[model samples]
Target: MITDTNHLTSLREQFAALRAQGLRARDAARKLALSEGDVMAAHAANQMHPDVAEHSLYTTMPLDSDWVNLLQGLENCGPVMALTRNDSVVHEKIGVYRNVSATGLMGLALGPEIDLRLFLSKWHAGFHVVEHTPKGEQHSLQFFDAHGRAVHKVHARPQTDLNALEALVQRHARPEARPVFMPGSPLRPPILADDRIDAPGLREAWSAMNDTHQFFTLLRKFEVDRAQSFRLMEGVHTRRTPLVSVQWLLEAAAGTGLPIMVFAGNEGCLQIHTGAVHRIEVMGPWLNVLDEGFNLHLRHDHVAESWLVTKPTVDGPVTSIELFDEQGQVIAMFFGERKPGKPELPAWRALAHQLAQGPVTVAQTEAA
Candidate 1:
């Protein structure tokens, strides 16, 4: 928590100036050499000063720490936008918050429209933010990790129930509370050499998988990094693909009207998009999917590696296109849409094979 009045005032001035220059909060905070949470916390503290309050562009109210209950309360807010992102991707889905439940620190939102895997343990601070925009006031619930990185955000839509939202806010608002943030921890080093891992045992375990979910257990059982596991089982179940694989995959899916699943998340929240994508566009380094109720922005330049992975499941072989960054962290994953009792879509499998073969000339790149 930043308690120095002068420092908070300076941050507000600089933040406001940057906002005026048309920089989003995340970029603006990065430009100011601070975490987005720190900047917001400063503004939250500034609200107490009448002089500062009058000139601020946004106001934040710290919320109570009952993350699960607060999320459950959001069900009253009809259609809302759920956003989750990492350094390389931004995933936005619009739907109601339903089937929201949690056990301990793990949670899930399994609504058909809004699906999420929540790790509440990393959820540290939350705020109800109201920003004054030219169009009107924009309201959102934003949550962050202990390191101040954003985990998830829920934005109100035009169809949202304003009264219920307001009531929920009033019920959970902790106006007098202070939110503190710590600096981010250092990044983990690269994975160990393949020679040091149990190659035969890892391959045997990979071959015996009965469900896609078991992959995580395999990684833990072998104490191997995800990418390293792929490297160890490259020939048997994993195959490296070109960096253009993602671009080709999205374009192909859009062209064939294929319904696919896209997964992207940070440490605190995993957001999934399921359905066909129609419009695909590229601007500079970003490859985007702009569709009704869903929007994906991916940094094509950050794709340090791509792979085609197949996991044996009771239903059949489940295939996915996995992307990773230079630091070996997963950027995003792509798969053919299918239910638990169903086999992988043959057409989707063919497309994955094409991606594995090599990159193709992108059919279109112009923004729609």
Candidate 2:
């Protein structure tokens, strides 16, 4: 927060030193106790190093203006990787930006290869970033919310239409200048109550739910956070499951070849994987699903709550394992792949049952 112009030169030098030491902008910021964007802007302001002659890791091209327009321009950039992630998950899909359109702060990209739910209201800042690597130059467009957390990112594949991408960036690039960004406000999550919840009422509402979308309204009506509501309605609508249940869920889906919906989202976007999982890989605490057009990375240890939720639907009982973080934000959700006229797959339900704490009571068995 050295806001003075005189300190800018010194800031860039320090950032450059860190980059020389091989620290990524994000991890460097974590060590320096600053936002990632702040660290990037500092070095980006520096003149191109005379030693390097041109492109360097210090280079960052700030892309400003109508973010939607920037996205639409990408429609011509063929075969790119679209990425959206939050704290616990990283979702990447490879596809062209096709059939893009927007109205107000909402957007849609119902391309056959790529599906996205865009909430443009949170798209406050963006940049076309370049990092020099041994293999060659890596290019990416990264967007951030008001709080400086990454919202969505796009990266070019080896066979992508680079000419089109370059043209788009050139058209929308902010004038030659130093890029600066405000850190904005930190997240202030509410301190919701643990008591006074209408547990029975919530269970009753859960039983009456005919659509999954109604769950949000149900939480609002009960004035409870998702994780808190799970605790309050424990014996009824939700059951506390083993922490290992997540691994079990993925393994079950892979073992049985069940098509399930894997949902990971932040405030701005929700990325989904709606098919059978063929590959499951674990690296340390992170669990990953590596498929052809999809990748899901989840840190199993960050799961503060994992609840097997049963809500009645016209098609029958819909069961989901909803994972939450410490702030009560949903890190991810898993549901059996199903259509309007279909009940949840029997295998999926049975897998969820294996994670349950105790024997299923007669009433619970009758829920579907």
Candidate 3:
């Protein structure tokens, strides 16, 4: 868990050096052993002050035994997959919910809340199962939520077949919890087009659906922003039309004078979005965006709010990019698409020389 030996050393030196300076940055510096600039600032602000009352209470009546029991209960519940692996950010999106076993028919759920009852009621016609996995453990579960983006996991516990899985789920499953389903008020007609046949069929289906049905149906495609289509649709309320491709949208974004990150969608696939976006365009499967030659230096799953990447490793080019995260760590690496025939670009390298010379910062006064 304690990563970055250099960072740790820097932390110690920073605090020691601050203490030597006889400055108010002492108390802050003393508690910290890492040289990270941000951590030092936090220390200086006295943010790390211990909660005395809470500490005293805990000392008198330690809750370690209770805490351990709580953790065990969560682990015993095992891992349950999301119906669809939509990134669990603060956003409303539509996606599918399927039982991972591949046995049940593919299920559907209206958005806002996508839960087990909704998936079972809508997709499986209320079929539940108890699964028996290789471990001989039995877990009653109905479905799995496959949140493949941020977390790649299958939600089902290893158990038996559909019937058994349902039985166990019914025993342990909470009945009151339900997935949010989008209400059908005014049907959202299809705007974008991929195939002519499918497009027309989608339009016909939209026109035929009632309000409630329309809401749920459109909720599935919620993540796919048909903003441009909606704008265009305002012109003609009737008749389905082909909305512009995500490629065109990215091209337009590139024309803007800003740094943009784009996950291009080739053919008819959906696009991936990231925070560090200025302009993004798609050329076939290859998404071409402006390159600042910066990369966030992070390992897989080592989430961070911001990364101050040092440039030029022993390998090659001096590339550094800062990445920001709230809770988990975000590792920055030079990532490129994998085309069928073309080779991929390597991640930014941090050679020894790059570290000696820090990042080149443009002066604001000079710019002014």
Output the number of the lDDT-best candidate: 1
Error of 2 at 278 (Å): 2.0
Q: What is the lDDT of residue 36 in candidate 1?
A: 86
The runs of at least 3 residues in candidate 1 whose Cα sits more than 4 Å from the true structure, single-residue gaps closed, are 45-47, 360-368
lDDT of each: 0.89, 0.76, 0.27
Q: Write candidate 2's Cα lDDT for 5-55 as tens digits.
A: 556556655665786798866666666666776655554433445454254
4 Cα displacement, candidate 2 (Å): 6.1
Worst 10 residues of 2 by lDDT: 359-368
Q: Write the per-residue lDDT of candidate 3 for residues 57-148, one digit (tens) a residue.
A: 11111011121122122333433333222211111111222222212432222222122212221221011222222444332212211110
- Per-model TM-score on C-alpha atoms: 0.95, 0.84, 0.19
| lDDT (Cα, tens digit) per residue for candidate 1, span 281-354 | 99999999999999999999999989999999999999999999998899999999999999999878878877
What clash pairs does model 1 have?
none
The residue ranges of model 3 lying beyond 4 angstroms of the native Cα positions read: 1-79, 85-121, 125-368
Where does candidate 2 clash, by residue pair? none
* TM-score between model 1 and native: 0.95
